[model samples]
Target chain A: MITIRIPTPLRSMTGGKSEIEGKGASIGELIEQMNADHPGLKDRLCDEQGEIRRFINVYLNEEDIRFLTGKDTPVKDGDEVSIVPAIAGGAHD
Target chain B: MFIIPSDIWEDMIDHARGHAPRECCGMLAGTDNRVTRQYRITNILAKLNEAELARFDQPKLSDLKQLAPEERADIAFQMDARELSQAQKDIRQRGIELQAFYHSHTMSPARPSATDITLAMEFEHCRAALNLPQPLHVIVSLEDRDHPVMRAYRIEASRATEVPVRRQ
Candidate 1:
């Protein structure tokens, strides 16, 4: 089981659980496991194309998964995965 | 109701002023509804390259890819992801939660504009989906350079209800 830390914004879906255990060989599968336990969690973190949303950042063991293989980044028991939403907006039309 | 002390209040104003035509943004963090600190986030508009811009699915942001880099910041702000992640961590470590997300409206009123409302609703959806408290959306209108106005709102169900704001 991989240790996944949920951000405050995304915790509601996790039943307010900050840390959740997921079983997967990669970040992609981990998300599947998590979404199974907490439905709709994937929509907020990923887009329709299954790519990580631009507004959300995922880190694998303190290193951004983007620096790794993104959703395919390998994970193992005891690995740490975290989600952080990008705080962004504006007054644009 | 949101009560902002004079110091943080002034800092927000100063941050908006300092950025001028370019909007400034930040987060308000606090414990027990009492705001304690503000984290200013850099707008990474100017740093966004074509490839990155194309990835923004938000209509308002995607629409900006046509505009010149200098002109884009005038109407929009996209926070630096690294800064945003760090701010959230720091606030958590400080034993407080991020209570509000704020940004300057360089040419509009200190109210949630259409774009702001739309985005706020998306966040509201996430908040509601998990039954979490929805954070406030604070806007500082710098339309009148000298007398900037700040306001806060609770965006729910696609509607924005103005919340009382006070400077302590």
Candidate 2:
């Protein structure tokens, strides 16, 4: 089982559960399993073309998936996945 | 007057353009309206190789790209301090504050991306630590040459608001 950590902005989709467990041997399967349990989240995280949203970032055990093996990257049991939304605030000159 | 000089704008444009294909990170410093300092904070390209991009998981990518909130704050603070130190040393120097931070989006729009927003929120704490009256966050879109736009925002009352700047 892989652990998925949801960000605060998307918590409503997960029933307010920050972390979830999924059964998958790879990252892609894990996301599929998560979508099966929590519908509507896949749309938010992936584009219509099935690509990960450019703005949203996914991390597996502190390593960025983009720099690793992408969605096909294999995941071992007990791996932790975190979803972080990019939000902006503050002043500029 | 928060007016950006044309030369500085040119420099910023060049810097943003140079870091295309991935993303560029940098700092902006100035007193009042005249910018006197700029520094590159990070280059995401350095962290990613061609092999990693082909086979990484989204979660792993997110985690690797994740700049810790505190670490970001520290970078801003350190940049601010360096600017302050230089300001103090310049007898003719005007009291320049670390006015804003500048970063670029290679394939994204000039408007703040989700990551930009998150980083801006983190930067607010750094600005507060320096007692800055205003903290500015700037995002540069390098996707188009003719339509490049820079957006500025401020965190006030725990919310982000647009702050207007006269384009040079």
Candidate 3:
């Protein structure tokens, strides 16, 4: 089982569970299984094209998936995944 | 509401003045809704990705890519993640929590703009990952240059609620 860490904003949908365990062999599979258990989770994690949102960063064991193999990044049992959103703004005025 | 000592309050104003024309950003740390310390962070506003930039002004990605960090600092602000982590650690060591994140709005009002509100919402979304409280977003508007207006608010989702600030 791989552990997925959910961010705060999306926590309201997961009943405030900070972390959850799911079964998957890759990052994509992990998100798929986790979303099956927690509906709407997939929408927040991915777009209509099934691509990770640009603002969201996912790291596997401290390595950014984007720099790795992306969704195809392999995930083994006991691996930890974290989802982080970019906090930015102030372009007005 | 936030209680800011007179000297500290002045410092914030001065900071805004020092960075006039450009936005300055920092985090305030304190307890009981009172600010005790302020951490000035380097604003990397123009360094943000294209997707985030598109929501604000229509600065072509090509144009932004051509300018340097110093040039970009004039219109946007971004806090370095490493510096933020260090500040958070120092604040925790001082036994104080991060109370608010403040930024200067050189050309806007003392209220959060649509972009600011979106960022504040993102801040709330990312707070748990940082183990910090939902910060009161503070804006220092320097539209007049001579007179500045500072206001605080709790921005959630798309709504903002003003939090009165008292000068102690």
lDDT of 1 by residue, A1-93 (tens): 788877665677888887889999999999998999999888777767898766567877666687678889999998888775565556746
Worst 10 residues of 3 chain B by lDDT: B52-61
Q: What tens digits encode model 3's per-residue C-alpha lDDT throughout B7-61?
A: 8888888888899777888889999899999988767665555444443334433
Candidate 3's DockQ is 0.23
Q: Which candidate is the best by TM-score?
A: 1
Candidates arranged by lDDT, highest first = 1, 3, 2
Q: Arrange candidates by TM-score, descending.
A: 1, 3, 2
Candidate 2 clash total?
39
Model 3 quality (TM-score)? 0.67
Instruction: Candidate 3: list runs displaced more than 4 Å.
Output: A6-86, A91-93, B48-71
Better of 1 and 3 by lDDT: 1
The C-alpha stretches of model 1 lying farther than 4 A from their native spots are A1-24, A28-55, A59-85, B50-63, B127-133
Cα RMSD (Å) per model? 6.8, 13.9, 7.3
Which pairs of residues collide in model 1?
A: A12-B130
TM-score of chain B of each: 0.88, 0.64, 0.86
Candidate 2: CAPRI quality band: incorrect
B30 Cα displacement, candidate 1 (Å)? 0.8
